[model samples]
Target: MKPVVQLLYFGYHQAMSCIFPVAIFGTLALTRIWEVPFLHRYDAILLILLAVQYLMYSSGLETWDEIKVICLFHVIGLALELYKVHMGSWSYPEPGVSKLFGVPLYSGFMYASVASFMCQVWRRLRMDMTGWPGGMASFALGGAIYFNFFTHHFIPDFRWWLTALVFVVFRKTWIIYRVRATTYRMPLSVAFVIVGFFIWAAENIATFLGAWTYPDQREAWRMVGVSKISSWFLLVIISVIIVAQLKHVKAARRAEPG
Candidate 1:
C-alpha cells in the first residue's frame, strides 16, 4: 500500500472496531438533544451499549475474552462512580429508574468504552511493550494511582509523586505497534499522555452532551478544565496496565523458548 493508504487502511480498521462504544456515547448525546421513543436517557444508553456489545461479538468485531475485560472495567468503574457521585465529585443530573445511589448504571459504560478502545487498538496494532518494569511495581503504581483518585479528596494528593515514579519506572519502556508492513515504536509514557488527552477531550464531549456534569458544568457547558488531563493521564496508566496484563502478555510469551 502507498504510505498514505497504509495509514488510512490501519486507521479504518481501528476506527471501525472501536466505533461501537463511541457510537453508544454519540447516540446518547444525540438523544439528549432530540426525542427518543419511550426509554429514558440512562435506560436508552444502557440498552444501546448492551446491544452494541452483542452486535460486536456476534459480528466478530470483538472476542469473548475482550468482552470479559470490558465487563471487568464496567464493574471497577461503577464502584468508583458510586463513590464519586456520592462524594459530589460529579453527578448524573438526569433521573432514571436504572440509577443506583445517584449514579446511572450506564455511566459505567464510559469507562468500559475506554477499555474497548484499548483492546481493539492493541489487537489491531499488534502492540508490544519492551523494557517494562516488573509486574509488581506496575501493579503498585497503578494501585496507588487508583487509590489516590479517592484518597486525595481527604489526604494530600500523591499524584505528582506517582507521576514522577511512573517516569522512573517506564523511562526505558517503548510501545511497538505495527502499521501495514511497517512497525513503529514510541516511548510508552508518550503514548499514555496522548491517549490521556484524547480521553479528556472525550470527557468534555460527554459532559457537553449532558451525559453527566461536574459541579461547575451543571449551569452551563464549558471546556473541561485542562487540569483534567493529569487525571486522565493517570487513568490511562491504570487502563493500560489492565489491558496489558490481560491481552498484551503474548509479546512476552513470544520471547520465551518454545
Candidate 2:
C-alpha cells in the first residue's frame, strides 16, 4: 500500500470519525453565518473549536505558530497519555487500538486536537493570553504542569484540581494585562450561529461513538443536542486562547516604544 494512499485513508476516517464533533460545530457556524440567536453562552465556541479541528485535518496545518505551540503541548501530552494507556490509567471505548504513529489515536489524538482547537477559540476570543508576564508566565508554567498530568508523578484528582487552580491564577494575572490585548466587538447574531453549529457537531460525534454516556442523552445513537464533552471542550479551548492571548500581549509590549 502506498504511504500517500494510506495517509489519505487515515485522514478521511480521522475526520469522519469526528463527525459528531463536526456536526455540532457546523450547526454553530452556519447558525452564526445566518445571523441567529445563540443557543447559549457556549454556542459560539462550539463553532470555533470544530472549525479549527476540521481545518487542521483537511488543510494539513496552515498556521505554523499556532500548530507549533499546540503540537508542542500535544507531544508532551501524548507521552503522558501513552504511559497511562500502557499502565491502564484509563480505558477507551475501543480496546487496544493503535494509530499509524504507533502512539495510539483512540483517546490521545482526540484530546490534543480538540484542545488545540479550543486554544484557537480562546485566543480569538481574547480570553486568556493578554496579561502581565510575572503571573502570566507563572500560568504559562502551568501548561507544563497540565502536560505533566496523567504521568506517574500526579494523581488524576490532583491534576484536575491543579488545572482549576492554574486557571484562577491565570485569570487574575490576565486581568493585570487587561489593557494589553486588542478587543474586538463581535456581532451577537454571527457569534451565536458559529458557536452553536460547532458544538452540535462535537456532541454528535461523541454520541455516535458511545462517548456521550451522559444520562441526558436519550438517543443512544444520536446526541442529545447537548453534552458534557462540549462543555469540557469549550473550557479547554478558552484556556488555550487565554494563554496565547497573554503571550501575544507580552510580545506586543516588548515591541512597544519604551
Candidate 1 RMSD to the correct structure: 2.0
Stretches of candidate 1 above 4 Å error? 248-258
Model 1 accuracy (lDDT, Cα) = 0.86
Minimum summed lDDT over a 10-residue window in model 1 is located at: 245-254
* Clash count, candidate 2: 42
Please list the C-alpha lDDT of all candidates, in the order they appear.
Answer: 0.86, 0.46
Give one digit per residue, the lDDT tens place, for model 1 in 154-257.
Answer: 99999899988889989999999898888889999999899899889888888888888999997889999998999989988998888887654655677789
- Check candidate 1 and list the clashing pairs: none
Task: Kindly list the per-residue Cα lDDT of model 2 for residues 1-258, writing each as its tens digit.
Answer: 456765564455445434433544454456435543533213333344546656765675434555555556556556655675455443333222243233333333345555455444444334433333454565555454454444424544344454455445445333211112334343322332354466556646654544323443443454454443333433353344444555666677999997
lDDT for position 218 in model 1: 79
lDDT minimum window of 10 residues, candidate 2: 173-182
What's the residue-level lDDT of 88 in candidate 2?
49
Error of 1 at 57 (Å): 0.8
Angstrom error of the Cα, residue 248, model 1: value is 4.7
Supply the TM-score for candidate 1: 0.94
Model 2's C-alpha root-mean-square deviation from the true structure amounts to 14.6
